[model samples]
Target chain A: MAFGKDHELHQRRFGRNLWVGACLLGFVAIVFGLTVVKVTRDGPIEGFDHTVRPQMTEGAK
Target chain B: MTDTSILPPQSGEAGFGDYFALLKPRVMSLVVFTALVGLLVAPVPVHPMVAFASVLFIAIGAGASGALNMWWDADIDQIMKRTKGRPVPSGRVTPGEALQIGMWLSCFAVVMLLLSANPVAAGLLAFTIFFYAVVYTMWLKRWTPQNIVIGGAAGAFPPMIGWAVATGGVSVESVLMFALIFMWTPPHFWALALFMKSDYADAGVPMLTVTHGRRETRRQILIYTLILVPVALGTGLTSIGGPLYMAVALVLNLAFLKGAVDIWRRKEEEAEADGYAVEKKVFRLSLYYLFLHFGALLAQAVLRVYGIGGW
Candidate 1:
């Protein structure tokens, strides 16, 4: 069986789709890496959640 | 299944490159480089990953504003020969698409920056987007000849944001870096206006060349260049500066001042006869002026790692 050739328009669409996929993957990887670094590194993570926590209030005491 | 052969060809459809072009990658590059220098030169150390992520977000923020600028300026862009072929003006992308992309990316970049870096950097990035897209593009650009002089602030903020990323606040060094770009902007742009002929005039944008005439623009270029010399040299005395930086600053400033004086001294008839050679030369040197200054700073930073960069 012979395969049909892809048109220029189809090729362009494919290229665009590929870039979009790559960008999404890259963004995900960057976010994951940032999260890992932030969590594993040493310092007080100042996340706010309405409820008072001991570590957050330690300076006041 | 539909036959592939039956699908209609859309010749005008925009591809990924067109969308990327909408982001003004060239401007984004300046943003990335300056911001990276800002991040590295700070006294406080940043994690490699955090620094990378923060700069990436800053570039994205700069790009988002670029897209928005293209969207707003599409009308004038179509008129200006230099910008007539941009994505929106060329009919490759819709204004609505550009707007949505810019808005979405603007939010994403700011929020991501906050998560990856600090609030100060993120806040500055948000403010930069607003300043470029709204204050400069919408308001100042059409209204005054001093548009670029003031709009230059938007471009100057990246380094400051980078410094804030590392230090979580601004300082003299960062402010000097900001001032360097801010002061450099007028002379750089005015030189281009001197050379580029009627593009700005035809576009209805009130460039100094259009509003104040070429002579005044040249005089203004000299004035700004004079003001720029002190700021450029002042940066070399800051904590980020070293003997190497000071030498580089002195040499570069002399060349820059000479270029500005050459531009100021030329008559309109002389420029028109020689295709604005002096103005073009100054424009070319201006590119190196910024790059070398930043490169010297980065070199000083690297040398500091080995115990001998700054005074």
Candidate 2:
């Protein structure tokens, strides 16, 4: 019904693949976003530093 | 003669699905998981953004390696029933196109890793791609029976790359991660070759089973399993290895060794009658071995957040 019989057959056969492709594209976009963040940041982008000693990390900084 | 029309359209226009298959996403996933575990377990923590970028590039590099492998193995792939329908062999994508995609992605991944992490990590990622596509695929696979033994280094490099991303240097822990995978590959693969002997034979790939014969292949698997025990167990004493990973490695290795022993004791006639049950079981265990080990490492990383690990 979506694309008539001939096209629909191809569609069903490949339908799940479209979602996988979309997800991969989404993954690429997220990586690109993270890369931009890392490039622009003065320090590490997320800025949640882990270098502070364990005792110091326990409290709000 | 095979009917040209019934064959799955060798010259057909490539679709998005065909292109995705070039990445070998399942294999890329293992690369990502091991890389993630390596990153998380490092004493020097990575910024989330930096970590994400590093892993993403590593995955891209893995995909590039896969594409190049499919390109080179297209002939043998067509001969093997398991791989006959892959993008290059079934002909949804042309060999030339796969080569171009692989080359471009390899450069992009290495450069991106350099920008996001350090040159050490970038260098490792580049070496991994070179090892897999050039050393392993182009040369060793066809040339030797010890293909997986030597070529396994390509798969083993991801964690080292991940560790370098966090600390900008390799350490004992990272090396242990690398060794674990490197040691595991042969037995993992040979077990599959045990049951699917005909496939390797027809493809002329010179797998250990093809070159050394089954009895020798079985003995080699046991020998490698013995060597793997000390390597797998020793990782528990390192920075990333904690109580959980130690326990998990202990249990999995014992189970694996037991399985290898079971396979070693069986003959071809008995195996064939039971549908190669023992070899099939060992093959299934081998698939989970790396995942469970890496999963325990990740679990230890989480436990560290609650103030427990690495002791």
Candidate 3:
């Protein structure tokens, strides 16, 4: 019961702070996740721009 | 009480959490955000693994600075209500232990970054650690009301270091990012000082609110906010940002300026009578102000790849 009383007091004073902190952390995690997605999806674009091929001669055909 | 009794009893029972608290996670978060923005906006591409390593090492360096700051400020921190429960002051960690941890991490982070990235980033990281721990914490904090103004440079270096990691050098774009955070620090911190003046006074910290009084602190907050708007917008004008960033910057700066003006126009008596509502609002808005500005910069980077703006 004593522990409960202390916990309740802490919840009263810092509940909002804790909630906001969690929300901010969650938001950051989501943003980082999205960044990973974007990076992976666009990874080939740079390589595509730089890729080169050699042409075969008609004698080889 | 004699001087001997005034000292905390020496104990060597620090836990993991106590050591983590020494890192100042909140400050680390801001460093990580700005550094990530710098990495994203750099002209040269960095490998994903290398980018991750660079940011991690940068975060560790920021943590090292925080630990050193806590070690140096422990005396004042013990007297301040807001800081009384911190690991050092609460006796969870010894000042000597904190100093050792900070110095060790500072070396480790800088060396690891140098091996992973380049010497430019490592050197900047070393300077940032020294600036925050020595210049800001040891010197400026106890001496002047303009402490936060000059001390803010340490916090402003992350983005530049990040840019260096990617490009292996500094550029105008990174400097703009640095300016944005530097100019924003005063208003952001002074708004908090407006509400927490008594804490600084009790600790003999000589924050602006304690030295110049609340009215002047509020006015300075407004002045800094005015300066911050143009700097935030200027980031958009750089090669790193685009039209999307410009639009976001315009709207955010307008709202921020309005909030600053509201804080400025209110009389002290009115603010006190209203439970310091205006100061609290400004403080909360300042958090979102930085986040939104940086978030828009990241958005502009993404849009540029799609050919929306940065062509």
Worst 10 residues of 1 chain B by lDDT: B1-10
**Candidate 2: which pairs clash?**
none
Report the TM-score of chain B alone for all candidates. 0.95, 0.94, 0.95
Q: Against the hidden true structure, what lDDT does model 1 obtain?
A: 0.91
In order, what are the TM-scores of chain A for the candidates? 0.63, 0.50, 0.51
Off by over 4 Å in 1: A1-7, A43-61, B1-11
| Every model's TM-score | 0.90, 0.84, 0.81
Could you tell me the fnat of model 2?
0.20
Compared with the true structure, model 1 gives a TM-score of 0.90
lDDT over C-alpha atoms for residue B174 of model 3: 89
Please give, for residues B166-271, the per-residue lDDT of candidate 2 as tens digits: 9999999999999999999999988988887468768777877767788899999999999999999999888788889999999999999999998888887898
| DockQ for every prediction shown | 0.62, 0.17, 0.04
How would you encode candidate 3's per-residue C-alpha lDDT over B151-269 as one tens digit per residue? Answer: 88999999999999999998888888888889888988888777764677677778887778778987898899888888888888888878888888898889889989988888989
Off by over 4 Å in 2: A1-32, A39-61, B1-10
Second chain TM-score for model 3: 0.95
Q: Pick the candidate with the highest DockQ.
A: 1
Model 2, A1-61: lDDT tens digits are 3654566547745765777678679768877887677677775444446575554554645
- Which ten contiguous residues of candidate 3 chain B have the minimum total lDDT? B1-10
Model 1, A1-61: lDDT tens digits are 9979998888999999999999999999998998888887976568889998887786875
